[model samples]
Target: MSTTTTVVDIAPVAEVQKLSLRAADPSESKPEGKAPEQEYRYAHLLPHFSEDRYPPLEPYEHVDPGHRALQHPNPRSFLDTAERVIEITPQLGTEVRGINLAELDSDGRDQLALEVARRGLMVFRDQGDFINRGPDFYLQWGRHYGRLHIHPTSGHPRGYPELHLVYRDGKQSFNFEVDDSITTTVWHSDVSYELQPPGLTTFFLLTAPPTGGDTLFTSQVSALKKLSPQFVAFLKTLKAVHSGVEQAEFSRNGRRGGTVRRDPVEHVHPVVRRHPVTGDEALYVNRQFTRRIVGLKREESEAILRLLYDHIDKSADNQARVRWEPNTIVLWDNRVTAHSANVDFRHLPDARHGARITPQAERPIPALEGLDLSA
Candidate 1:
């Protein structure tokens, strides 16, 4: 009883179609009666409140462009609601409760925007209802301010050009320490490259990882405030050129792709930019886009820019980190703060996807009360 002769052709190893070598084999599970146990570990993000950095901020009250209080009859009624405002960090961000962002009316939105303008950003956690509402909800929600911005390079998701996507699926691996929130791991404004930088940029975290992807935001208000009056006086006399060329070359995913603008729009604005409504000053130069300081030598420009960049990145004393959870909305004023997405999550199966909308744009202008370069 001999077996029939057979011939088999083996395929080349190159054609195995990319499988993870570390993946366990089909038979690698525990025996029928035994199971492996997962060790429990937990961590919490600490929010720092520095008196020197935050001092004490007054609640923002909306004053109409005409400086009339007609639009705000019962302004104090906003804080009177069930909403509780918690100052997570003195630098900029605040966590607000008792008010449902998804259910706010025109008046409620206006009051909310006031706090957002004053605080730099307002974070709404535990917003499960808004999870499936999609971009349409956010578009209408943010429309209370102005039209949502459409990025020319970062291709908007399908028909929603107004909604810039901050969807990240970085290294689907894991760690006990940190998670990779957003891939653009740099200290930069949302779109300083634009002729009109975003005034208000809001994001809703629909999906969040278990441990990583914490975003960090620095207060330009604090950045400017901490500087010596002499430095601010010097900065007021200077103009920095923010180039859109490099940014327009990259896709929404932060890679170099899409329609490369031949000559990206360039805007020269003072380093100390004043908020149009509140008249608050923010150090406008960012690490990524503000290329040069006009009227200065190359060396001088580099030195000054490097110093500013370092200051923005190192303003941890005046910065806050947000550990995102599902249905969390972070509304940050791009006009007043710079943000950096931390990618500390190595390769966790963690996925962080969100919708970001930039509401309107503002031409950065410096308040010229008394500008003297030489003190």
Candidate 2:
């Protein structure tokens, strides 16, 4: 069969009717999968727990076997190492230098690992080239302890299925616009919201905004030191309910284009958690996901939680703010320090982005193993 050749022009016509169309009316686009930012209205919900109403928090009175109270006064000696270790905060956190992490010999790596276990945190700055190696570098450093954390659902990096990305996006992706501009607010250790929280969080920042985006770290041990004697005693006897349900619920169904449903896991951790490595006790309550005091009445729980939250949030001399330099890697003991990122740079189109490797801890321990709480 012979077919006739035909030409079809796909180009637009040169000239047609000159119809004037009014500019398409502009419409505001609400970000997808995010709730409208609402003002926090819980200030009035706090209960006042004065000394007359509630019992005072007493000092710890118990002592463990083979450990004596006030005998070893210097806890800093636990972190001393031959390698260069510089204190970043008066109470906690240290930066180690004069060693190449990329090429650490087996013995050198082992020594560094021991120091990290003791110091709570170890920082390396001006290592732009080292971070370029990406997850491999983290694996190299973390292999001795454990593998990296794989998040159950959200807060993971894009195109890096193997590596968890801790970033915030405006619309379709995970959004937290309602709260403060910072990414993480309320002083907390990484993944403490989970039933089994990660042990250590190692973050390497490849890019940071010119201004803002500083990470503030404070020692929970120092926080415990500042608390009134009565509060410490009260916390020792209480347990707080921590749940990942709130964030999991939001991620799964609360917003549009949400992820799969995951049940909230609840675990009760001590209000004062002791460090398994360094043997220092720290105030462990955080404002974000800690729901209630397990045995207390609702009113009593509210009263004490308000006090503890305020105590940790205050800006004090013991707090240290690290202005991130490009390619700086910070490894913090999730068991010891509470950190919040300064989010002043949210207005910028491109802000801070990095890869984080969090390893799960074997178990949580008290800072002072032998301290008596019943006294």
Q: Please, what is the TM-score per model?
A: 0.74, 0.69
Best by lDDT: 1
Clashes of 1: 13
Give each model's whole-structure lDDT.
0.61, 0.54
Error in Å for residue 58 of model 2: 37
- Per-residue CA lDDT of candidate 1, range 1-375, in tens? 001100111111111222111212345666778654321110000011111111211223223221221258764355576557789887788887665667766676666666677888788865655545555776887666765556554424444556665433343211111224333457778767555667766776444556777888989999888889988888888888887665644422234223332335676777888887677888888877889988899999999999888888776788998887555778888888888777654465445545677776555667665433221
Supply candidate 1's per-residue lDDT for 116: 72
Error of 2 at 53 (Å): 48
Which ten-residue region of model 2 has the weakest summed lDDT? 1-10
Residue 265 Cα positional deviation in candidate 2, in Å, after optimal superposition: 1.3
Pick out the ten consecutive residues of candidate 1 with the lowest summed lDDT: 40-49
